[model samples]
Target: MKTDDAERPNMAVSIGRLMLKNPVITASGTFGYGEEFAPYLDLGRLGGMVLKGISEKPRPGNPPPRIAETPSGLLNAIGLENVGVDAFVTEKAPFLETLDTTVIANIFGESADEYARVAGKLTDVKCVDALEVNISCPNVNRGGMDFGADPEQAAEVTRAVKEATDLPVIVKLTPNVTDITAVARRVEAAGADALSLINTIRGMSVDVYTARPRLANVTGGLSGPAIRPVAVLMVWETVQAVSIPVIGMGGIMNARDALEFLIAGARAVEVGTANFVNPAAVLDIIDGIERHLGDAGVDDINDIIGTLDCRRK
Candidate 1:
């Protein structure tokens, strides 16, 4: 099942200095270290594989009942559980180096210093092509507000990460704020090489008869089909506000859904909740995008990026 090179569309995409084979990357926290999905699909087929978020120290994560389901959406309260940076460097780095795809490390912490340390730790790892800063975590020094919720905090963290590593830095944005573009601009100004946005929206589910929350954590990030529209909207608004390559995510479940983000202005789209439903989701999206391009007479994937016609008819 292969299309000849001359007949096939070019799917290559660039995010800063890192070049991906395609633009269908697996979202961080959704795809686990890339090694886990190797048996399910060809990991090399993906443009990039973003590992689960790693922290300054290992976290037990929220206790069980960490997941809940709803109509067309899923909720998770995993609490950013990870093997910690040092352990990840030893346990995960070797396996990651073997993969043919671009490997991106998603990192987060309670404070800017922690983020800096984590980025510093991975700078020497040859397997990690870039550092993706997950700014959705709380700023421990500043009460409990999210680093991404405030322009200054977000940029500060971004600056910290950029200063710590020579690797390209891609700051992942959260949708919990009033104006996402404001944060996007700040991060870019702070020296982020690229950006990925519309992380899961804060949401919850409740049990009827039990008169209690469905998850042990009570509240979790909502993802899946339900958030695609909101994610696309933010991606569109953000692309208009910033010059860096913006990768879009949140609730992307299929090739058609993936295309929505691409058409709306995202340079790439990350498959999140869909991975849980289908381990081969990334492969499917790549194939679907190729087919779509062939059918539309498009020769290169980048030709269609940010081509949305928003003018009112």
Candidate 2:
């Protein structure tokens, strides 16, 4: 017998010290400084919102034609364009302070010291609940993906940020590496409170007629449904390899996709590119997950985390 969908389950979940009312979060870069989506949906309804990647200083980002559509995903070389930490705190923090939901700041930097500096800057911000270190931005020429791809560099960055901020630190991982679990373990040891993966896969598109790259950068991070499978696998593996919580995101569009990540091992899931297509996608996912839980007679969502049955045939 199936339970009625009208009954709501306990959807609250924790990632390290960050407690989300539900498991659905808006991925960084997809949701701008929490102001852009205000006209579309209630920011307080989301479990958490990871703001666009912020740097130590303002970034102009790459030139035009920074985004392109692929078969089932998007290629972007936006270069982590942002108003920087100073502007974000002065201009954006007030709005976020009014919201009831958790707000995680996604930050990037050119070096370990810079990462520490950025993290330190947000330490006194009352609205920022946690920090999601964006070490996996592939489109950037310096820092970003470079530190994430190497375990030593990744750990160093994690340690630096942890030392700088009292907020829970989540190191977002890059899938372009050969062994994601290796970096996961290192970050965990380096004192990362939680982890998020897999940041867009490195890819490129070309214009056959023009004999030129589709994006001006020649390469960019591929995101959306195309990378969901890879994100699931990495989340599954990283959860197994590390003790910290795992926040999963790649191509999550609905509750089913989010459930897949939870079952695979993610404690919470982030809606990325899907938000671009549907502003209400995050709320829909939250509703869908609640329905799924009620139908399954599950009173709590935590029971499903890393509950995948890997029995061999």
Candidate 3:
């Protein structure tokens, strides 16, 4: 594959230890192992790609009626459906290693020991650029709530993952908490190299005509344009509370939304629900950002990261 000259010129943009050509990344569970969209867009042009969440064992995931469309967003309870980490290594990782972009493996577990074991295994996989600890999945009954709703538990999970691997770890935060910033601070103290927020907000809807809930899971994570403002606000608050870099996502649709996250203190932004509406959204966002930066007279993209207009505490 011939590398695009535009993407090769600036390769020093840092996303954790690995430098990327830019700061635009694809959110996990949306991009799907970095190969599905490769035919439509150049994977090398992206800053990085976050693979779907991986577990110790395969997950069949929720049954049908897992997706419910809202006015301007989507409610999903896909239940982290994936082929498991071990299978991913043999089947997906080999192909991913050939790609030019950075690879971030999103991992999840039901307990700290499970997290440690998974991270330990990923450490041996050279294709993985980083490990994104998905501690905010609300679809499951056990460890999902245990780590996400409590700051102390969140920290323990992060600490365990960090101890199990040398790779940079990114803890994805949930917005369902009363004070999302508190959880971020605790995770940072626990040795998270970076943070990503806000995961979809919890929500549910009823089918008045059918007399049942719209989704099989009863409740699902809310994501899309409706949640953009909330995500921006939470990302800004988290940036204020922690010193580690943040990767923000939630209802990000265009360049403006992505820039809002960058200014709000996210070192990078992820495109999640937006991809379902437009498979080309990632490419469009990358172009839109170049135009936005040029219009702002900003030569360096990193200058806009964490540049919120407020009194720094």
Candidate 4:
């Protein structure tokens, strides 16, 4: 994490039509509904909190031993254990609405129609600031990777979800593909208002004592410091491939890591997995960005975004 003289922070970030005080947000499915962590941190200080992925129906998630700890990261097969959209609107949404920060609902579905139906329901919920369509879920059955791996399928799902709601649509993409840029272009054309990239890279681990796989689902998405480099490259490439704004996440632990995503061309960055390790990690990242800017003599933060000096050879 380098804090050079040229470093700074973006004054404001617009994801579709919603304006953020800064670009730092908590990744979906990890922040619960935003109320659990309210005791330790100020929810208003964050640009927004993407609530855990809510499905059209309640999901119990997977069996026990769902999470396994790794060196710099952990593997989890929680299977999107959520209280469903209606529960979120009735309970979670109301609580989040009272917060000064924005609330972005992360919606997931098993099929294109499911995506549309859920988006339609979320439209009536005024408290929701935007809709983040989770097309890539490694823990779910029949819904996770099927829609994300193919450009047409991804676009179709995005189009259906977009047509179902007036809320700004942000389609999250999977890293399990060969060319993520191609899918980004397709989803953007299909009516995605913005995009969030590099969802946890799909991965797995084994338990030596049990002589079996660690995660009950056999595999899970990997997040933490280890994925930072790949996330930066994906954000950079996706930014070059599409015209829509990009929200980047993957292995972001602090302010310096957050700055790398911006320099790589992400309009905003989402903090994931790190929350489980350090409850104050998000605030640390935000404060660090501000401190980095002040020390570098840069007042406005937007100036540092996408300022990399790479040249094609």
Q: Which candidate number maximizes lDDT?
A: 2
- Once superposed on the true structure, which residue ranges of model 4 sit more than 4 Å away at CA? 1-10
Expressed as tens digits, the lDDT of each residue in 1-313 for candidate 2 is 3355455578899997689999999999998987899999998899999999889999999997999999999999999889999999999999999999899999999999999999999988999999999889999889999999999999999999999989999999999999999999999999999999999999999999999999999999999999889899999888889888999988998899999999998999999999999988998899899888877888899987788999997
Once superposed on the true structure, which residue ranges of model 2 sit more than 4 Å away at CA?
1-7
Q: Cα miss at 19, model 3 (Å)?
A: 1.9
lDDT of 4 by residue, 30-130 (tens): 78898889898999999888989988998998997888777788777888899998887888888877898978899999999999998999989877889
Task: Rank the candidate models, highest TM-score first.
Answer: 2, 1, 4, 3
Full-model lDDT for every candidate: 0.88, 0.92, 0.87, 0.87
lDDT of 2 at 128: 91
- Pitting candidate 2 against candidate 3, the one with the higher lDDT is 2
Record all residue pairs in model 4 with backbone atoms less than 3 Å apart, i.e. clashing: 9-301, 9-302, 10-301, 10-302, 29-52, 224-251
lDDT of 3: 0.87
Give candidate 1 misplaced runs (Cα > 4 Å): 137-145
lDDT of 1 by residue, 95-194 (tens): 9998898989999888899999999999998899998898874312331237888999999999999999999999999898999999999999999999
TM-score of each: 0.97, 0.97, 0.94, 0.95
Candidate 4's TM-score: 0.95
